[model samples]
Target: MEASTSERPAAAEGGVAPMVRFDRVTKRYGALTVLDDLQLDIAAGEKVAIIGPSGSGKTTVLRMLMTLERIDGGVIWVDGEPMTHMPGPGAAGSGSLVPASQRHLRQVRGKVGMVFQHFNLFPHMSALKNCMEAPVTVLGLSRKEARERGAELLSMVGLGDKLDHFPGQLSGGQQQRVAIARALAMRPKVMLFDEVTSALDPELVGEVLTVIRKLGAEHDLTMIMVTHQMGFAKEFADRVCFFYQGRIAETGAPAELFGNPENERTRQFLSAVLEAG
Candidate 1:
C-alpha cells in the first residue's frame, strides 16, 4: 500500500539509498494491529508529511523509529543500518539479521530525534539545561561543549533570552521550541515531529512552524512530520502521504495530492477536514 508520485522514484532504484526504511514493519497491541506491514522509504534531507485520521497509526511510526515501541515483524533501517536488528555472523550489508542488542539499538537510534505533541520539558530545569543534559550524558560531550551547542540551538529557535527560564516560566510554544532545540543538540540525521502544534494555542502555532520552516531551509536533516496542519503541510512539505487503515492510500507533491487526490478515501478525508475547519 505504499504510494508516491512518479517524480519520487522507488527506493530500490534511487540514486542514493534511503536514510530511513520501514521494511514490512508491523506493530500490534494485543489483538489490535496498529501498523500493518508498513513499507516506506525517506531519502536523506527529504521533507515528508504524514496525514491521517486518528487511530490510523501515524504517531506510531515515529515511536517505532524512536525505539519507544518495538515491532512485531520486520526490520527498520536507519542511515543504511538496521535499528531493530543486527547483522548476524556476516558482513554488514548482505547477511541474516537477528534481534538487535541494546547497544546496537542505542547506536542506530542515535541518528533520529523526535518532538512529541506535548511539551515534555522538565519543569525544574532551565530551557538551557534541558537542551544540554543529553549531549553531556549520552553523547559524552563536556559541559563546556554541550553548553555552547545547547545555547546555539536555543538561539537558533529564537529563545536566546529565555535560556534561563524554566518550562513553567515559559509559554507552551516557547517550551516546545526548547524541546526542538534539545533534540537538535544531539545532531540527529532524521527529525520527527508528531503533532507538534496540536497542543499549542491557536495563535502560538505559527511561531513553532516558523522555526521549523527555518530549520528545513537551513539544515540538511531529513524531516518526517505527522500533522493535521493542512496549510502548513501544503506550504512546507516536499511530499504528502495520506494514510488510511494503517497504510498509505495516496501520496504525491502537495499541490497534486491536495488539489487532485486520486483515492476516494483521501478525497473524503480532505473534504471532511476542510469542512470541519
Candidate 2:
C-alpha cells in the first residue's frame, strides 16, 4: 500500500523543522521496490526504532539515510537541508530538490554517522587509531586533537584500557563498542545503528547494548536504529515504526505500539518475534 503524507507527522510543526524527513522517498532494486514512497519525520534528539521482518526494508532506511544506498525518488532532508538533493537557488535549503553533486553529498554526509551490523573496522589499526583516522583525515583535525577525542570516546564506550588493541585482539562485543565510539568521534548530529548487535555472540549483545544505552542517555544525538532487540527498543525508543512491505505498517510510542498495536501486521510481527524469543 502507498503511504500518504497524512500518515506522517507534520514535517515542521510551529517554527521547528524535523532533524530528518523522508519526503515521498522511494528505492528500487531492478524490478523489486524496496521502499515505496515512504514519508517519515524525526525530531532532533529523538531516538527511533525501525522493526520489521527480514526484507521488509528496515535496514534500507538506515543505509539510505547514511547514503550507502541512494533513493530512486524523492528528497531526504537532514538538519533542515537536503541530503539527497541540492538545495535550489537563492536562500539555502530553498526551492525544489535536484540531483546532488558528489561535493554536495560529501558536505551533507558529515552530519550523519553510521555503525553497521558487521564491525567494519580497519584490521590493522588499533581501536583508538580507527576512531582517530576519520577526524584527522576527513575533518582535518590535528592528529593530537583527533587522538585525544578518540581516546575520550573509547573510554566512554568502556574501552579506555584497550586503546592499543587491534580489532582482532578485541572480543566481538568490544569490537562493536569500538565501532560505536568510532562513529561518535565524528560528532554527528544524527547516528544510525544498523543491527549493531546482530553480529555479536549472544553473550556479547548485552555489553554492546549497555554502551548504546549509555550513549543515548547522555547524548543529544538524533538516533535511528534498525534492531531486533524488542525489549531494548521498547525501553529506549521514543517512537517505534513497524514496517511491512516497504511501507510503515504502524508507528507510535513504544508503549502504544508494542503494548497495543493497532495494525494487524504489527500485532502479528510482534507476536511472532516475542514467541520466537
Candidate 3:
C-alpha cells in the first residue's frame, strides 16, 4: 500500500544536520567527464542554488542526487543513510553480492523528488490523475485517497480549479506548476529542481517562482535547484554555488557571491549573465 503522508519518513531535521551530502563524487560518460570529485553538504531546510554556464554539470548534480544518474565513484548520503552503498563484489553486507539493490534504490528514490525543465506530465491524464498515478501505483495508495491527496496538492500549487484540465489545455507555466505538485505528492525530503522555469514564457516565470518561494518558506525541504534565474537565485537561496568545468568554482552567501565574487570565473559569469538579462 502507498505510505500515508503521516507515515512517510522525512529527511533529517533540526539545526546543523547535513540532510544530504555528496562525498568526493565523480561521474564520467566515456571520454566526457560530467562531474569531477565533488563534495557538498546541505543542511536541513537549506535552500541552495547551483548557478553555472551551460554544460557546467548543474543538472547533473540534481540528477545524481536523485540517483537518476549513477555515481562513478564516492558516495551520497541522505538523512544519515548511505544512498549508493553496497558491499563489494566479494564482501559481505546486506546479505548478497549485489552492489546496489533495486529495493534500496526504490527507498532512496522515494525520498527524493525531481522536477524537470519540461513539465513531463502524462498527456493522456488530467492534472489530478497525473498527480495521483505514482502514489496509487508505486506507493499502493487507494484511488480515492490518492485523489483527495492529489487535489490537496493541486490546490496548494494554485491549481485546485484546474484538476480536470489536461496538459494540452494548460499554459506552460500551469503545466510546470502541476509538475511541481506531482513531485510534492511524494512528500519528498529533498526536492531537486532542474531549470524549472527555463522552458516558460518570460511573463509566466513569476508565478512558478512564487510557488517555489512559498515552498521554500513553508516546508522544511532540502532544496537543491539548478537555475539560470539570477534574481531568483539571489533571493531564494541561502547559499549560491558557481560551477565551472564540472566542478564548484565558488560558493558563498547570496550577498558575498553576488556582491563580491571571489573567483574571477564567477565574476565573468555574472557579468555575462547580467548583460544578457
Residue 123 of model 2, lDDT score: 96
lDDT of 3 by residue, 1-277 (tens): 1111111123445535588888677888888998898888888788999999999998999998888888787677777666776444554433222335777878877889989999889999999999999999999999999999999999999999999999999999999999999999988999999999999999999999999999998999989999999999999999999999999999999999999999999999999999999
Model 3: residue 82 alpha-carbon error in angstroms: 1.3
For model 3, the stretches where C-alpha displacement exceeds 4 angstroms are 1-15, 87-98
Model 1: per-residue Cα lDDT at residue 179: 95
Each candidate's lDDT (Cα)?
0.89, 0.89, 0.86
RMSD of 1: 4.3
Question: Clashes per prediction?
Answer: 0, 0, 2
Q: For candidate 2, what is the TM-score?
A: 0.94
Across residues 1-277, which tens digit of lDDT does each residue of candidate 1 receive? 1221111123566578889889888889999999888988888999999999999998999999999998888788898887887776654445567788899989998999999899788788999999999999999999999999999999999999998999999998998899999999999999999999999999999999999999999999999999999999999999999988778888899999999999999999999999998
lDDT (Cα) of model 1: 0.89
Across 147-176, the per-residue lDDT of candidate 2 in tens digits comes to 999999999999999999999999999999
Ranking by TM-score: 1, 2, 3
Better of 1 and 3 by lDDT: 1
TM-score per candidate, chains pooled: 0.94, 0.94, 0.91
